[model samples]
Target chain A: MGSRIEERFSETKAAGRAALVTFVTAGDPNMEDSLALIKALPEAGADLIEIGMPFTDPMADGPAIQASSLRALEAGQNMIKTLAMVKNFREGDSHTPIILMGYYNPIYIYGSQRFLDDAKAVGVDGLIIVDLPPEEDQELCVPALAMEMNFIRLATPTTNEARLEKVLTNTSGFVYYVSITGITGTAKPDPDAVSRRVALIKAKTDLPIAVGFGVKTPEQAKAIADSGADGVVVGSALISVMQGHMKRDGKAASTMVPAVTDLVRSLAGAIVN
Target chain B: MTKSDLNTFRAGPDEQGRFGIFGGRFVAETLMPLILELEQAYEAAKEDPAFEAELENLQTHYTGRPSPLYFAERLTEHFGGSKIYFKRDELNHTGSHKINNCLGQILLAMRMGKTRIIAETGAGQHGVAVATVAARFGLPCVVYMGATDIERQKPNVFRMKLLGAEIVPVTSGTGTLKDAMNEALRDWVAHVEDTFYIIGTVAGPHPYPAMVRDFQSVIGIETREQMMAAEGRLPDTLVACIGGGSNAMGLFHPFLDDKDIEIIGVEAGGKGVETGEHAASLTGGEPGVLHGNRTYLLQDEDGQIIDAHSISAGLDYPGIGPEHSWLHETGRVSYVSATDSEALAAFQLCTRLEGIIPALEPSHALSHVGKIAPTHGPDHLIVMNMCGRGDKDVFAVAAHLGTDIEG
Candidate 1:
């Protein structure tokens, strides 16, 4: 079984700091650089990592992440390369958990059983596939759990109490609560309102809740922690930083990895009590 | 109608929505909450006089419904068959039956207080229809199209853009209609609140198939009256192509009570059914669940859906609508296949013989007319629902045949 997400939550809580979840596109720029960032993330103070398994179309993601996915795909990244990258991550850092987030079709194309076996073998801790809804858990969730890998559910602000309960019931790993009603990178979430909702979900679920989809900065992360969230997930903001660094003419990109990691590091410190 | 007559044709899925062994609410547990809400809202809307009045008004005003039942004299004579009548759905504001459902769904979206309309399209017909309604209601519209389809159907892409809809070309999973659907569903998951997913066909979770079918059934409702008035008898045969089977089922539904009528659904046979290249779900597929309902699917032995191929993009789906599956199993409608060669022949036949170019999707049905007309003879009247004109397919068809479509 892969390392449990709760293990990190407990560690972060004992240290009096909210868990810092950083998202990076798996093959962004290329596999080599992405692997470096994946290893660098934990050292840079990110308590957890959400590794984007770049699908050709990442519909739920906003411009930054989507563009990064395009760049990754153009650089010849697929599920095979993505899993290989995770395998590399496992070689060095065994404590930090990695979640593979993307759509379902790639998994469907790659045999579900084969994928589960491969993901588990590579030390992938979980998945946050936007397209694989709770109804579709039979396709991958069972196998993922059987292989001891978590299959995280992306819960939204509009996910009502009843729907939230159902999502929570089926969910295996931590729940990534989207703070806003809009697409990723689009909404500027009201932290107080998001926290109240998170608190309600927390009441319903004994599982850890890592709020995502708009928690983009140190301030937002600190606010989410204050509001009773176990973890604060930041994705688009770091992507925006990386994208801003890379020139679009499609040449080699130097590692803004250090600069982006600096931002996540600052957020991680802010989340520390 | 007599009890004996009602026995001739089958309606339903009776009210509770059961179509023989197929179709019952086989939705995901999460959507159950939303589905219940929709069912209640639809029930109230169905009974409200204001709802019907508003729909009737819009159908008349915006869509120009009650389109002419065009009698194809030249083509009928050349084919030497029973007289053929075209339901001029092509005359509807968007030049297809798609708008009929779009207007209704867009209105429902408005009533539900949604500020955004989202849809996935295969051939761009549904995208155009949804965009048209979005413009009329002044809602922000977003369309998801497979990157491949976006490149193929460029004109329709421009049409949607001109109508003020944002087009997001989906670049995943073979980038076809199915991929577009996956992306659209993902969009709905993120923006479920204030967004009404305007599904293009009679597919998706429960209420959508039934709802879209109901809206499109106006095609049959109009054709039935027109044919009855003109021929003084119902058609001996009713034929239309099936993709998600919306257009076919729409025209066939109202005629279900008429025992004298024989119904046929033409599926795309890319090369030929015998060559293991076809979309003839009832003929070749096994029963399986896909796109939210249990239906006949063209899946491999491993239960993986095989990619379907067709000269016509609209008719190349790997599965049939659950209701159509029910109709096929119960022998209410005969499902058949038409090859690329056959459909192309029919496309050329219609243009040369009748001066009306039918879309490749409906031309599958058009090709079947030759086989059936000879068996039934000229005395037996067959009314084929010519669902669309051949504009979008002209480029694809012409390039295949090595002939340029003259302006």
Candidate 2:
């Protein structure tokens, strides 16, 4: 286990509650409001933060998260800005585990070794590149794990028992069980099925299992937590809150950060209780 | 990197499916298992003689294969240099070489017991091919096409609809071929249980590029045989236009090991590569990952995919197939570009001289042929793949030529 992710999961276990892992684009609308939202997430009760490094083509994301990435890129978000955002977030808060997630092109262009070294220097805890599976681990995952940054792997419903072992081999962080087989925030995942899949994953490794993809509201998060997951991830739901506060010119409204934090607070409360 | 061991350029993609540094299974975790399964199924089908026999039968009876290799005598006389021949893949059943891949993949999909079919297209030739295969197989088909392409290639759009395909107009990411492919991938992820995505070209992940190339290699195989019978010798040169490089790879792959056969691939130079408005990935782009493989991509310094522009919708993609990237890097094939106006001039010349109105995609190749054919001796043989007919492009061509025609 890595440092911040391990400590956070241990704390959540001792607290007898599932951790609320909130996700948001690093530069959605603009960099300033995005930073404000990131700074406010931990105080609103997010135990872990997954900052999306925007790419031009986000294949695995649904419409909401896809829109957020486009908005970020349009606002001049790049790998450098994203890492700087993580650095800035680390200054305000140190306990929250920051995981950068997205496709791998920008990072590949940014130079893999350089990006990983910079990310580790600036206090990034983990990574969740959706495109890099166990087959292509040599590309980035192996290097990231060596950096003491948890290389999180997403195990989807399509991942059979044989393939699950491969997914868990080099995974340092918790196992992210994509509750649905589809893209993010598209379909609703059944709590019972998610519970069964969580147990299936937990039987393989000691890594805590986190349920994501289709987790939206407080009730859904609570239900997933009750299903024995160590964490519940809410991404498109939070981005939808930010989307509601956007102006005509495609910038975030003044209420965007606060509204997103408010929803995160409610979701965190539900998961904790 | 040893030159002595590098004997055959045909043997590629190793076990991890990489050609040099390009081409790997870079997809979301949800689709990895499916890709592996498809790879397994394709390997099995390759070994099964029954599968080969069925495919061959379909190729002969269904697709009207062995498309003629005609000598462009008038154009040869006009050029007054090299003797020119055209491998008329445009004479295939769907009027394009896309049916060759669609038929092969649909057979594989059926062998895997997939109940539905999905595909992405730019000029709608591939969409029409997939829809035709799905109709023949009695499976539900969905085609994701860019809204801009649907507007321009309306005839092919109607043909896909007429074949009972659900045409989903994709509006994201500049509304072009790349966007359509993205949407198709999303749809495949959501419906991974029973859907088989028939990637239109030689660009996708591992088995896709290899599999599509194998399926379309019939063009090159037939060209070799026909050229031997017609001229009693191998052709000196092969030329084909590349969008996602399917037709070019089809005609080029079988000849890659033939060291003496010079090969050329033409990319769409929309307004010339210098203007930064072209789709010439090899000539004007750098290596990056997109659409499940690492290849030469038209991207900015920040790695954002810059939208490509070309008058022909089929040639207006930002990236080429990974194998092409390998071939380009290793100097196995010469990559060049032809501008829109040049292709337009070639389109008119081909129609008037050869009495074959070639599709705008292959017009890029013909334009290159016109450039170099006159420089070679009359004894030299030049064969170009006429990959598609111009029936689908007549409206666009007419509009480009400043002529108004009523449908």
Candidate 3:
């Protein structure tokens, strides 16, 4: 039984377009609105979903996503709530791939083996731990692959050919090629440069390449998808829109879910066109 | 934990940078290559005599090395028990031991051909040190200081500006040392090409914890020699305050092999350890990963990092150096804490008794010294690290004491 992530990529490839990967911090704003947003994602056109487990310190993320994680934590998000969000989403939709993404401290605190067990039980398809490079594979990656779960490693502009070999060693599912050298949501990546880098990584691995980090607009996502990426991941852009609709009292301002889903639909339409 | 031919405490952080499952290069892929490059450059620097000679010359003339290890005659008479000695590192250039590590790192940054230097500072002592070194070396320096720290450490902030270093105030996560570090890491991630991050503490990633410790180890090496010249033997006990454990690690690393010498690291206990408002990571925290390495961190059960509180800004961090975690776990070093009130009392006591105003960072150690000194007999000798001067902390201390000095 192939994982849901691999199946999604294969299906997207069969449809002759790149997959639209969307990310949102679980429990952002609040749990009720968060669950509603997650359930609404698939129909609005996200082929793959990445739920960020809120951490107090998110060194890799830029301001937009950092603020989003802070919002989630302020609303009392934890590892259990993050996993439960996935479980809630799974009850309605089991076909769309769900990946948990964040730093390793929360999971390390949750116990890696136990987190994997609970995550797998709740239908979490993959993981994208930002801090755990290939060097510290024994901590989570190797064990994750052993359980037949996908451990997606991020390849950046700094990841040279020699380092790329190490990065792709135990990596499963797909490769997240960070388009820029900086943190998430900061600088816009040049599509030409990103395409070439993705092609270079593609020469080495059979796994699909999903270009992220500064990918926001439908036009930008379409441009990267047209240039040969198998997937386009949008995060900070979506979170920025969600931030606009959040009330000062920390409640969703009613336009939160619709506004985000509308943006996702446009991005999906651009990718799947 | 005793040093033997077969088992030396010095040989640690094996090839993968693991100090017995404590420290590792827990960073993003973008930082891995840069970390490896730094490790290579440092390895070569260690082997080259030219590097050693240059560092020595700077330490001697620039930083004024061989910092006097003074006998605290009055404190000894007052306590009337053990003979106390203070490793007077506060007399160095920039009025703190922070210059020792900054000089070594600025030289390394030059060797790496990095044009821009960035650092994160808490109380601004490390910021001043980095800024001073950058001025000497003619490199453009940027120091990330938390907004709260900038407000509290206005004098040090001005010192950095005077030294021609740009100070960026970080307002994230309570606007303290941890936030500044997070901001600096984010800056490093963006500008990885020609920028070198000069981490001020014995924390962060692999080479940093080990490298900063080596640079700051001059304190211990000199203390060993100075004690030998003064008393013809090693001291009975060694003590230093820990803020990310750099100054303490500097004094303790060289003595880890001495079976008879007891090493105590004093952490900042805000109100008290039980109040859940302290920065005593070893005493009140558990092992967790933050700022690129695994160490004892003040975190909740759900692993969210808790904000640390302490009277001393330098000691207000939630995490500690990874090497300290290893040393604590191995029972090679004893970790204790001093409360804000205790350290404040020690600050005034040292100033009045010895006529030497020690920084609040070292005051934490001095407070611990007051407790343990009277417990020992006259033959018992104790050495505590006076890592910095209290000039920068005077305003904050005055405010706390309700002196109401008008600016």
Candidate that would win on DockQ: 3
Ordered by lDDT, highest first, the candidates read 3, 2, 1
How much is the lDDT of residue B286 in candidate 3? 96
TM-score, cand. 2: 0.99
List residue ranges in candidate 2 displaced over 4 A.
Answer: B1-5
The Cα error of candidate 3 at residue B64, in Å, is 0.5
Alpha-carbon deviation at B313 in model 3, angstroms: 0.5
Q: How large a fraction of the reference contact set does each model reproduce? A: 0.12, 0.74, 0.80
Report the candidate with higher DockQ, 1 versus 2.
Answer: 2
Q: Calculate the i-RMS of every candidate, to one decimal place.
A: 6.4, 0.7, 0.7
Where is model 3 more than 4 Å wrong at Cα? B1-6
Q: Which run of 10 residues does model 1 chain A get worst, by summed lDDT? A: A246-255
Q: What would the per-residue lDDT of candidate 3 be over residues A58-117, giving only the tens digit for each residue?
A: 999999988888999999989999999899899989899999999999999999999999
What's the count of clashing pairs in each model shown? 0, 0, 0
Which 10 consecutive residues of model 1 chain B have the lowest summed lDDT? Answer: B24-33
Cα deviation of B228, candidate 3, in Å:
0.6
